[model samples]
Target chain A: MEVLDNKITKFREGLAKTNLSFREESLKYAEDTLTELDFPTTRVERWKYTRVAKIANTQFSSRKDVVKQLNLPIQDAYTVVLVNGYFDKELSSKNLPEGVEISATSQSANNLLGKVATIKNEVFTALNTLYATDGVSLRIKAKTIVDKPIQLVHVITGENTIATVRNVLVSERFSEAEVVQVFLSENANASFTNNVSEIIVEEGAKLVLDKLQNESESNFHYSNECVQQASNSNFKINTITLNGGLVRNDLTIDVDGENCETHLNGAYILKGKQHVDNHTVVNHLKPNCHSNEMYKGVMDDQSTGVFNGRILVSKDSQKIEAYQSNGNVLLSDSASINSKPELEIYADNVKCSHGSTTGQLDDEAIYYLRTRGISEKSAKALMVTAFISDVTKRMDNDKVVEYVHNQLHDRFGWDF
Target chain B: MIKITNLHASINGKEILKGLDLEVKAGEVHAIMGPNGAGKSTLASILAGREDYEVTEGSVDFDGVDLLALNTEDRAREGLFLAFQYPVEIPGVSNVNFLRTALNEIREYRGQEQIPAKDFLAMVKEKSKLVELDAGLASRAVNEGFSGGEKKRNEIFQMAMLEPKLAILDETDSGLDIDALRIVSNGVNALKSDNNATIVITHYQRLLDYIVPDFVHVLHDGKIVKTGPKELALELEEKGYDWLK
Candidate 1:
């Protein structure tokens, strides 16, 4: 009991210090759940390859500082800056298009706060709910087509800092929008970022979320995104992870309506002692829905990668088609990957498939390239680029694709 | 352009090429005909620096340099080209992109400026036409889903683009039909000049019919047993390799 108390005290020392307000009943429930749950272990099925003891044992303090400017990837985007989980008004853009609103999640008193994300058995979601400093609540009104993409930049700085944020996104009927979430860090050592997002797509709405995680090597990141889609809605998300010490992402999307399209694509390139875990779940509740998931990873040195994709087709949800694929390439003997694909179908007349593959580069192909006067190093680089491009190409944004290539070249020395 | 003196090689503790000797000068086309298991492809592999074979005792001299001392890519940069008997199908690598990279790397080794993009595309257009290869296939993956005849023609097209001082065609006619064989031979003959040489390794004497070799060497039991003019190919094709053995 004393050890658990000490762990909670250290992890939550200076968190939830913002003066912003939140729902009274929701905060009470989250705090009660935190007392009942502890940090998960590797023995857990969802976290079989990830160990979170380092994040639990570290003593972190809340940090908030001012910065002059940021080198944003898309210069013309409608930007929002969150520094150490605090919304920076001066750094964010004030001009907004018609029918689009952006405000702090803490100040927004909406009934949809605890509807999508569940905290009953999820420890991270509970932690994020209780100690979230501040985040953006973006809403697109009905029938609004936002031409410019919305950019959300989460900047983490200082040593031993812990930032917990909560975001809410809602796309109304017949609306369309794209959101880019970029996670960056500076001078961070042993920092931890715990984030949770609850999203909703109304009828005939379209939303695309492109996330880039490029934190420092010493930082730990955990993100939980829960989405609910209505009828005739489309949702596509791309998660590109370049650098992180230990990262875990939980994406749960529920297709509660008919004729919806969902696409989940992710690519992670890891080296050194980094570890990344991606767990996704798609639930088909209505008839005639389609979903496709593809994830690719390239691990080098002592890095580790994990992928768990689960598809569930509820009863009476017929004529559903879902496909999932996960592929990995291990660049070193010490690097490894653990992949698990699961499907639970209680409905009849549905088509679902899942597969996983892991292997090294082809040696015969290398020799063939060498005979054409290409060095072995460049040969492997070309093949790896081709392998990862399958997922990166689905980003569908030129600026984001260029940013990913630049990150790969700067961090892993892989020039395409 | 190349000289092999008492060349011996083995794979997996079994000898393949034993005491093989051959020499070729610039502007000459040499045809090496032999029965199967007589180290016809083995000679091609060793000259191109395939690491699977262990050179027990041998020396290969190319243009006054020790060919056996260089790596496979270094040997390629030094003006040696080998068309594989079975061209590997590399998915996701375009032929034009790979050839461009190869050309630039070779030029860098020779202390030359990078080829301009305009000139590179022009060269590709001209060289691909030499073998009658479709310009669309140049942008597709290398040898992927290519027909056997198309693959053979693609090999000749690559040879034309590289323009090496010494070219080795290893069973380039094995899977090609008569039309493809004629086209490939025509491309090879068109690229021949006074500054380059070619070694055509074939089991039958069909390829030599078009690319008319100056010297025809009959290899039996891992060594060249007879060297004669181009008429020797017809004689071996009629009498079989057992007479030479």
Candidate 2:
């Protein structure tokens, strides 16, 4: 393998030096893959709608520091804080439950890190694999039902910086837990975050994860979530992105066993020159499995949104039911969306469906509301709220929902 | 309570209401009986500030205020309501929630405080009953999946909640059954008062039989061709609109 691209060489040389080390074997694999991979361009099918030239062509510095006063959405949850891609022990919550273990990936001996999230074909995953500073490592013991939610807060600070954060979560057999991962920024500019999360749900285990990305308008965010589910396991993830200059999320779920349930939902609100792209794939390898995915977006000003959802049912995966839908609302003539929902079924006895809709708000509905003494602004707000409520209501966490509503109000002046 | 003079309106450069004039005093119900394409709905729409129509020459006076100058919501805030012929279905927006918003915004426009949650709920309960509307329907999405009769009843239910001074029922009886029409008329009659008036735009005399309009006007060829007592509805019902034309 040879690294010939000068852009890749420049980006690699600009990364902050890492004093922490991980498994030597995994690191070698990542190094080899990184040498063979170049920065993706528009020609790449997966990164077609997303452009990485802004990240690749710029020089970035990595700096770490502890800050005072970290405002969290869920305050009562067991919180783990990471500042500038490094864990800050002084800020994390202490006194975990008996059956739950929460530690930084740099401190934990995690064998499942590179097993689920492959760095074979993806360049960002390889980059995160080689130079990840710190991330969360959460493990739930078998048959243990965690009483409280666990939150991981990743805060990026400073200007012209890059943070590679990698996380691994393992839910043992018959365990149930809820985890929230929030990406926030503090006085940051021209920053980039490359995040990769590897999740494993054992047989009879259930895991629910909520991810909120609210970075600054000048930051770039890219995240990859790789999940594997055993037989009789259930996994659900909700991705809510409120603000960012540029964001791309890649999520893959591999259902390797029978009788598993998987749900993936996302909602994004964009304004200004923001851009958000979400690509998700769900592969069903066994029978008697169910998967449902829905993503909704609202774009205003000159913003753009892209959604690509794929569901693949392998041969002999009988009795598999999969549904995917993407809906978008453009508030301005300059705003736009590109949505494609694809389903591939190799089995004869399977039910798979996909749909995509991109349009403006219902004009008749707006007029109806206006005739009832509601202002045009409020009418649009109400209709947009109703449009995205399908995914937001299914968030199932009132605190998170309230926080999102508050953010909407603060950012866009939408009363709903 | 309201008066319109020489209202000329058009949509897509095609004239709908040409030199149309109407007047409704306090404590009266006027039924507008018209054939198809006679500008009945255009009159109702222009009064409620539907933007699709271009009002070439018109002046609407609502209690000495320029009704035409206000926007749709402002016109609504000024106590003018239009019960649409086809009520829109707004999915996921509950009837009660939107009604509360409309009522509060109207109140705010009138320099009043927000309604208390308890009192608002009580009002919803009372108003829904007047239209014989099911209590569950008030909490459901606005007109979504409602039967035709139920949608008309919901319109009446909204009128009862808002308590407008000049309510224009534009073909509110079009899709209603006999029983539903009676229920809706009864609700409208119960809400009538000396301070408010109603303009009932209908094609039949059955609704007038229940609500008992004070006067009936035959609208034809973009204008009111004739006006008479409530018995005029009976006459028009007996002899078709051809006699007036």
Candidate 3:
């Protein structure tokens, strides 16, 4: 208790230095949550396989001077920039889709906004809400579909700096949209980043959210994503974490209605001393819903990867079908992977299965390729590409899949 | 132009080929028939430079070069091709891409420029027709999900593309139906020329009818137990290996 109070006091002191709005209320919320709730530790069920508290105890401060170094090529998509957890309108674009509404509001605005108010209980969420100068609230009107993807870029630039950002997405009935959140850090020094995003898919709606985390090797990243799907709605989340120091992502999907489909897919390629952890939970609250989760990791050098997936089928969720699979490949002997896939079903009529496997490159495949005149290195690269091709094929967008393939080839120093 | 003298090979510390001797000049077709566990595959593997089979005491000369010393891919670049009894399936690697890479690599190894895409596609179309393979199968992943007969036919297609100096078909007749067998044999026979040779290893004498060999050798217990003309195959078929035993 004393340690928690001291950490909160230190956090409050750090926030006081940042000249951002809602300083007082954010500090109060952080203090209250810190004192009331226990910080997620290694002992926590969901966090058992990951050690996040060790990163939180490092006494990171908000990066006040780090916002100037980011220089990204201007893209055609509607671009929004969040620097060190604070929205920067000067660096962002105002172009948005038709029938889409975006505004900054307080917690007591309405029921729609009230759903985001629960973020106060999470320390990082509370910190983002408290220190956030402006939060992006996106609401799509009924039956409206956005053709362009919304690009959210989060840039971290300073050393020993901590930043938190929040995003709230609400899709109206029969609407469709896609949101792409890209996290990048320009500097190679030590830094900390915490991000929270909430997505609500209404009845008969479809939402696709893609996350690209390409932070520096000296940064610690933690992200929490929560999605709620309504009747006959479809929600898909694709996360690509390419590089980071210590990264942990938490994804929770709640199927609140029947005939809904939820897909959670991710691919991570890590090297050096990087550590990446992905934890996902799918709760089937209604019957006749389908959920699928597939996550793949490719680790080299002394890097470490972790994957933990859980599927929960409630008693009334009969005839539900859920599948989860986690596959990893260790490119070097020094690399390590820890994967755990679990299922808990209270209904006997439901079909739920989960599996995980970790292996090195197939030797027979390598030999077979080499026998056909391909060099050992090229053969290994081909096998690695083949191993990850399934995940890339799942991306319905050709350009995105091509971009991912190029990124993977660049990492492996191969020209595909 | 291949020679193996006193070749002794082993896999996992178990000797499979014991002091085997064989020689084949250009423009010659040699058939090696044997019973099960007769080390015929071992001899072919050793000749193709499969690293899993160690040449404990042997010497293999291919086109006057040290065949045993070359790496698998280098040997492949040197015009040594092995048509595996069980072809490997490589998913996501299109057959066209795979064959193109192999051909270009071999060409580069021989100090030649890459084949132009137009020329290469023309070659693929021509060779694919020779093997009676569908154009769709030629673009899919390398041998992935291909039927047994299709795999064999694809092997011959690759052989035709590579134009190896010495083609070693290891039990290419197995798992292939009569029509596929005829197509594969026809493809192989079409590829034969005066400047290259072939080593056909089989357990049955039926395939020999389609691909008639100039020299037929019966391999038993890792050694050539008998040598005769193409009529030897018919005789062996009429009188099973029990007569030799």
Candidate 4:
């Protein structure tokens, strides 16, 4: 404990002026919260399957650089470019859409920032809060239904750098918007990316978030997404983790209002020695709310994956319908996965169920494809795409679906 | 186009095909009739390169290429098609898309270009009529929620699309109705030509009535104990296997 405290103190000192700037009050409060927190150990029940020893033992310095090059995959959409934890104006769009705002300046209303994400056992979010600077504050005005998606991309250009980014997305009443957030690295060197996102969907609003994590094999990525959904609102999140050396993602959604709907879907393909852990929580606090969560993983070679999903319905949350399912396919004997889907309901009138399944690629199915003249590689790719299609097809956006499909195919060197 | 010489195969040390030899030529239709546990399916499985069955002796030649040396998919690309007894249900894979992919792969193997979308669709439409496959089934997921008869007919429809040089029907008549059986056999007959052959594997003589075979072989305990003309099927159907032994 003493050694960890000393390391964290030195880490805080190491992050001193490299953040560009943070609101003084927010920084102090975040630091105070950090003092009361610790890196999650095995003792933490929520993080039992994930081992963070290497992360806790390694120290990463901050990086600062101007944006060199960035590509936007989405068309006719506003883009915000953040390079090495700071916003880069040269790479961002000059023309902002009407009724939408993207700014690097901090906002004073911190209602859901620290409320949705649990801080006691989350060191990444706590650290992000303390060192976040130049993060965007995006607001979609009420009754503004944006046809084009808003894209946010972060590119890391540093070696062994710890890049912390914080962003807040708000969709006001009766508004609808699709948002795509991408995390990529230049492969310049090994690095760690810690990202914190807080989303708020007001009454009668709809927000779709697509997060694509396509990092180099040498990088480690940690992301925490906290969502607060209001009455009659619909919120959906699709996470596609295509590649990374080590990755951990935490998504917690609070369905706090009546008649609200939430959808949480994740798909990941891991090969080589890559490791990925996805932990999600959906809390139902009101009546007549619906939430469905599904995650699929395909692991090959000696890679490992972990999925822990928990759905909680409070005592007064009546008539809540919640379902969670996790499916994993192991391609090699050495590949392994730990999946736990749990449902804790205090409401007598709620309908909730959770299931976890793990298996290898179906041999009979492969033979069937082969007998039809499909090669082994093509057949395996087809089966994998089919396995993950359940989650990918849930994506209502065609562009996002195509992007994910391309990534999955390219991972196997299969032609799309 | 296929020749199996003194073939010996086993599964887990138990010999299934013991010293079995057969010769099939282009434009020939051969029916292998057998009783239960007679290695009828094993023969078909081995010919299609199923890894579960290991051949300990002898060899198979497909169009003069050592068939035993090829992989399951390679055998398939080399113009050998096996219509499974039970078609697998592949969810999220449409019938047309899967057929297109398979056809393209086969063409690529044969040094041909991919078929245009319009031509492929037209071919699908024309061949689907051979087995009377519902147009809706071609657009839906492959064999998903299909009836037993529909699955059998779908297999024939696929056979028409691939148009292999050699087609093996492994109990394709089982679980199918009389109408389905007639449609399936007719589809097979329509695809047969001087350049192609068909192997019909069955336990009953009922299917042979629709698609007459030039030669009929009785297999018992992994070896061909009898080889005769189309009349052999009627004899087996009337007298059963007791007299053949």
**Among these predicted structures, which one has the highest TM-score?**
2
- DockQ winner: 2
Could you give the candidate ranking by DockQ, starting with the highest?
A: 2, 4, 1, 3
Residue A152, candidate 2: alpha-carbon lDDT:
92
Residues B17-123 of candidate 1 have per-residue lDDT tens digits of 98999999999999998999889999999999999999999899999989999999999999999998999888777898889989998999899999999999999
C-alpha lDDT values of all predictions: 0.90, 0.90, 0.81, 0.86
- Assess candidate 3 and give its lDDT: 0.81
Query: Model 2, which residues run further than 4 Å from truth?
Result: A1-5, A16-25
What tens digits encode model 4's per-residue C-alpha lDDT throughout A221-282?
Answer: 89999899999999999998988888999998888899999999999899998999998989
Give the per-residue Cα lDDT of candidate 3 at A246: 90
Write candidate 2's Cα lDDT for B58-101 as tens digits. Answer: 78899999998999999999999999999999988989989999
Q: Which portions of model 3 miss their true places by more than 4 Å?
A: A1-13, A17-32, A36-39, A65-74, A102-135, B115-122, B240-245
Docking class of 1: medium
Scored by lDDT, model 4 comes in at 0.86
Better of 1 and 3 by DockQ: 1
CAPRI-style grade of the A/B interface in model 2: high
| Quality of candidate 3 docking, DockQ | 0.58
What does candidate 2's lDDT look like per residue over A34-79, in tens digits? 6767788787788788888888887877788777887677988989
Per-residue lDDT tens digits for candidate 1, residues A1-416, read 12345466567666654443546676777777667657777666677789888989988878787767776768889999998898989989999999899998877776677678873567788788877888889999999999999999998998888888889999999999999999988778889888888999999999999989999989999999999999999999999998989999999999999999999999999999999999999999999999999999999999999999999999999999999999999999999999999999999999999999999998898998898888988788878988888898788788988889998988866765
